[model samples]
Target chain A: MSNTFLIILFVLIGGGLFLSFLRLILGRKATDRAVALDTTTLITTGFLVLVAFLQGRSMLLDVALVYSVLSFLGVLAIARYLDGGLR
Target chain B: MSFMNILAHVVTGLGALVLFASGLGVFRMPDVFNKMHAGTKATTLGSVLFLFGLGLFEPSWLPKLFLIILFIVLTNPVSSHALARAAHNEPSEKPDNLIIDDLEESKGGDQ
Candidate 1:
């Protein structure tokens, strides 16, 4: 049962990541790509947590935590740059 | 499987599904603000649900999961807001659908 659940999860998340990447490539505007990038990072964070659970290694959760923080900062920086507010 | 195990599976599965929908929205939305709406709200909810489900599987990880959820909830809106403001400020990507853009008028007057 757990194995089946894991398979389903991997497929779903992989599909999501693929779609986000597609948007990043096909997006016409900078903000469109930025939104896609944000979604990709968030899904990746969830993927990391799922992997941590599968491995029984609590330490990987810390990595997921840090990744989320960094992604937030990245998005903020990107937004500032796009707004021309960053000098 | 036990009750908690089954519950975790359901919760986590739902989270993954929500995430997939968010991705679809990001890809399919016609405008940047619409994409941000989908990307930010659904991603935050989906990740929080996923983390909560994981915590159910390993009770010891609850505290850290809660911390992550809290941080995401707090920061996702701020980042998205920044992005939306930036998009609005950029003259190249002004939203085409708005009938009454109060911000533009105010900002225009101030300038």
Candidate 2:
């Protein structure tokens, strides 16, 4: 039953990811693309957590945590660059 | 197989649906700001729900899942706000529709 749940979870996340890719392709402007990418990263983090559960591994949580932090910092860096300064 | 596991799966499935809807909103919204609003807010909430469900399904990693949720709630808004401000600051080719220009007034010493 856990395996069945895992399969369904994977399918759902995969569908969400496919939709996000479509957004990246069809987005009209730079900000629109950035927003889509940001959403994608968040979904990826969730996907990783689900994978960790399916694999019965505690270590994957650490990876998910680090990815979450790094992605947030990356978005901030990009926003700063767009804003013309670190300030 | 257990009732609790089934409940967890249901929560995760709902979260994924929310994430998919947010993605569609990103593509369908009329403008950048609206897309940002939809994507950032909905995805963050959806992800938190997903992680929470995962934590319930895996009892050993509950602490880590809580930390992930904490990090998400804190960072998502900050980054989204920064992105929106950056987009707003970029000069557009067309004049924006405005009834009042407070920044312009302050610049001209019209206090």
Q: What is the TM-score of each candidate against the true structure?
A: 0.95, 0.85
Which lDDT values do the candidates have, in the order given?
0.91, 0.79
List, residue by residue over A2-86, the lDDT tens digit for candidate 1.
6787899999898888999899999999999999999999999999998998889999989999999999999999999999966
Score candidate 1 by DockQ.
0.84
Task: Tell me the spans in candidate 2 whose CA falls farther than 4 Å from its real position.
Answer: A2-4, B1-3, B93-111
TM-score of chain A of 2: 0.84
Off by over 4 Å in 1: none
All models, RMSD in angstroms: 1.3, 3.1
Question: What is candidate 1's local distance difference test score?
Answer: 0.91
Name the TM-score of candidate 1.
Answer: 0.95
